[model samples]
Target chain A: MDAIETNSLGRRFGDVNAVESLDLTVQKGEIYGFLGPNGAGKSTTINMLLGFTPPSSGSGTVLGYDLEHESVAIRQSVGVLPEDFGVYGRLTARKHVRFAIETKGADDDPDDLLGRVELADVADRTAGGFSTGMKQRLALAMALAGNPDLLILDEPSSGLDPNGAREMRAIIREENERGTTVFFSSHVMEQVEAICDRVGIMRDGRLIAEDAIDSLKDRFDADSRLVFTLDTVADDIVPALETMNGVTDINADGNDVSVVVADASRKAPVIEAVGASGVTIKDIRIDDSSLEDLFATLTTGERPTSRHAEENAANTTQLIREADQ
Target chain B: MSWVHVARKDFADALRSKLLWVLSALMILVVAGISAIPQLLYIPGQGPAPGFDDGMSFMFTWMTMMVSIIGLVVGYRAIVGERESGSIRFLLGLPNSRRDVVVGKVLGRATVVAVPTVIGFLVGAVVILALYDGFAVTDYIGLLVFALVIGLVYVSVAVAVSASVNTRAKAVGGVLGIYLIFDLLWWTVPMAIYWLLERELPGSTDLPAWYVLVERLGIWEPLGILSGTLVDIAGVETVSTADRLAGDVPFFLETWFAWVIVIAWVAIPLGIGYYRFNRAVMS
Candidate 1:
């Protein structure tokens, strides 16, 4: 059975359609990444699936239980770490986990759960003084209390430092390895690409793309750009590289030549073509479109928004200003 | 069962709150001070001024007011406070239904209110027995039960208001409105009704129905029911002028029926509030 299945499930807030006609499916035991930009209906969809908010139209189910009527049963089996959850300031970490255990009727040890989240040392301390990251860890420990069949975490890596985010990824992997279906939502592409077996991207209350990481990269027609630094500029190299199969956009400036190839397999032929021009090669660099680039292309559908693109734009503007001077 | 767990946790958490402790201390002082009124100011030949029954009635009046205030303090933030702080997400993320949340909140806040009320009543009982020469244990017990029921009635009203409103300020304002109307201005309602009838009809020597209707309206007010029930239970005529203005008490004003009204106060608001609470969308 699918871990989560929604058939055109939609929700509207007043006149604003927050989630509209969203049909999604997540197979059991796979870590499904839910990716979206801000205000992209990610939280709204999660809220509807968990029954925190009802859908304005359509139908859905979690673990084969009806979303609307069997919410109690679904909640009993599915653990949720909501993006904007709050801890009781008076309750300690242990108390929070214990409450979840009691609520789920689960026979899990609170100490073990807290220890997994690295919160064992301060298990007795109240959460009132906890930092944001500490609170996130405590909430994660509580969500793991029942050994649930499915775990739905919204922005689980939020508020965590680099090391903390790595630890969170390890925990997600551990949970997924234990035959648990994990539905993780995040805006961090690196984290999602590292752990997710399949991903579904939401854009403006709709699922824009859903596939494996590699498949999504392929579907977007991501290409590799080869940069070569030569001893001298060769007039024949640009035309020679452009005529080659699977090669396009060949440009030479001073001693540097860059070419966009349709795939990595075209790398050898482009290098051979450059060698035939009789210009001595100084260095060669191959820059492939990573998932970050593909994400930018798929989401924004234009110039990549990564730092590299921003730097390139800045350098190009500087060159234009210098020429004017 | 889920509600029981929620209530148990809520009760434990509320017990640790500084606000509950402050209210409990204030109530204890009030009960002690009221109990010592007879001994503090004595008049010779006043025929044993202010015996146990009078002390009990005085304590009931003060305690009723305190209970109303305490009920609002305990219940005004029950549901809306969680929603405002975003903790309702953590709560409803569990296996609990919305009905469970409302039921558990009411039960937990009722305990918070009941604890201090019981303590104050017990201390008052001890003081009355020691100060007065002859004190009936049954009458003291009767007053204790009556006072507790009245306290619960206020608690129900407060919880109902909390559940019905979406913001803490609105919940506080709603309960405060209940307090002003039922505790302070309750008698004016029946008086206004009588004046309207008199103005319209001009001549009605025997207005028994109007009198009965006025007495019946008393059931809606916690203090009215408390005084009426106290009169029947202890055979003490502590009811206010509005009740006696009818010259003869109606059957509905009897002590036994007064108990019914007191219990109904606990039931009716809770039922309506729970129904609305179950249908409300949790943020």
Candidate 2:
């Protein structure tokens, strides 16, 4: 069974539907990145999955247990790093982890869990005294208690430094390697792109896109741009390049030529055609879109400043607005 | 039970606040300090020196009031504070049911009141035994048990208020309003009803059964009835039920029935709190 499956699950707070008709599926033993901008219903969706908030429409299941009715059973085997959670000011790091272990009825040593999160040094110290990064790790240790079959982390690296975020990614990877399904949410695209096996992007309470990173990049690659600085740009070469297969546009200014190709395969032929036309190429740079660009294109419907993401951004913006309506 | 873990965690966490120790000191001063007052004030030439009964009655008056305040202070923040600090996300994110949180908080805060009470009584026993003659062990134990029950009652009320609201301000208002209306001003309820029904205030004795029954609904009324039977000290609220009522005491006014009311004080608020709490969205 999928680790998590929601069908048309939605939630509304009065007139605003914070999350609406979300159909999400995350496979078992996969690291799924739940990405969205703030107020995009990423947190709301996570809240619904963990039974922190009841959905106003449809149904869902986690670990094959009913999301609404069997939340306790689901939580018994699922570990969570909830968003905006505060540590008990009076409880020690060890106590926090111990509390989670005891509630899960798991016999894991609190110190051992704390050690994994790099919190063993301050295990006896009250968590209230810890810095934001330490508190994040402490929360992670508590979430890692019982060696849960599924991990639902809401912005696990939220308060961490780069080093801490890298460590968190490593731990998440380790957990996923142990056959645990890891579902984590973040507004940062880099963190998710680094480790996620699959990702689902939410925008305005809707799942706009879900796929593997490579596939998303491949789909986004349709608008690749190849820029060439030439010794001289022939007037005919501009029209010539535009007429080539997969060449959508060609602009020339002061010996600098830019070619927007419909696919990556068209890049080489366009350059060869220019060379064959006797234009001496001075410099060559190819712009490949990253997941960060993809995220920008998907969520805000805004253009990525990178060379070729503009056309894809316009299309995605049109697609998303239509999907939203 | 899962609640056991929650209670243990809650108690351990509250211990760090030092509120528990402060309460113990206050309780010790009230229980032991007040019990010694009758002896301290006595003189050799006085017509009859103050006895054990004198000291017991002196301290009993203050003990119930202290326990009520301590219960409210400890419990009013038990659940609501977690919400205010965003820590409840950790609480409900685990496998615990909302029932576990409410029930565990009541028991946990009840103990915050109970521990100091036990310490105060233990110390008071030694002081009362040394300073006064004829120390009644069962009577002393009865006072201790009575204090515990009173503490539990208020803690249940405060925790109920905590569970029923999301913000600490609302919890504070709720507990304060409950204490003020029920504990302090409840006596006026029956008096006003008597004034409206009979066109005069209620007299001290020979009143209607319904008049006195309305007074019993006050937070401390049933407990007051209980203190008579629970402690059985001659000097402490010694007025019998029949003397105040116009006729024989009704079954509801009977001391045994007071136990039912006191228990309802504990169970009813928690029931209502749990009903609201279970349906709350953590968002």
Query: Quick one: best TM-score, which candidate?
Result: 2
- lDDT per residue as tens, model 2, B1-283: 6788889899998789888899999999999999899899888897888878899898888989999999998999999899889898988889988898998889988998999999999999999999998998998998899999999999999999999999999999999999989889999988998898889877899999998888888789899988887787767665677998899988998889988888989889999999998888888
State in Å the error of residue B39, model 1.
1.8
Q: Looking at candidate 1, what is the lDDT of residue A19? A: 92
- Per-residue CA lDDT of candidate 2, range A37-130, in tens? 9999999888888888999999999999998999888888999999999889888899999999999999999999998888889999989889
Flag regions of model 1 displaced more than 4 Å. Answer: A217-222, A226-262, A266-286, A300-325, B44-49, B190-223, B230-264
In TM-score terms, candidate 2 sits at 0.93
The per-prediction i-RMS, to one decimal, reads 1.3, 0.8
Candidate 1, CAPRI quality class derived from DockQ: medium
DockQ of 2: 0.77
lDDT of 1 by residue, A1-325 (tens): 7999999999988998889999999999999999877688899999988888899999999999999999999999998888887778888889888999999999999999999889999999988889888898888888887898999999999988988889999988998899989998987788799889999877678777777877765633435577899988755578777778987457677888887776668889889888888889999987755566555444443455553342233222332243235
On a 0 to 100 scale, what is the lDDT of residue B48 in model 1? 62
Give the Cα error of residue B276 in candidate 2, in Å: 1.4
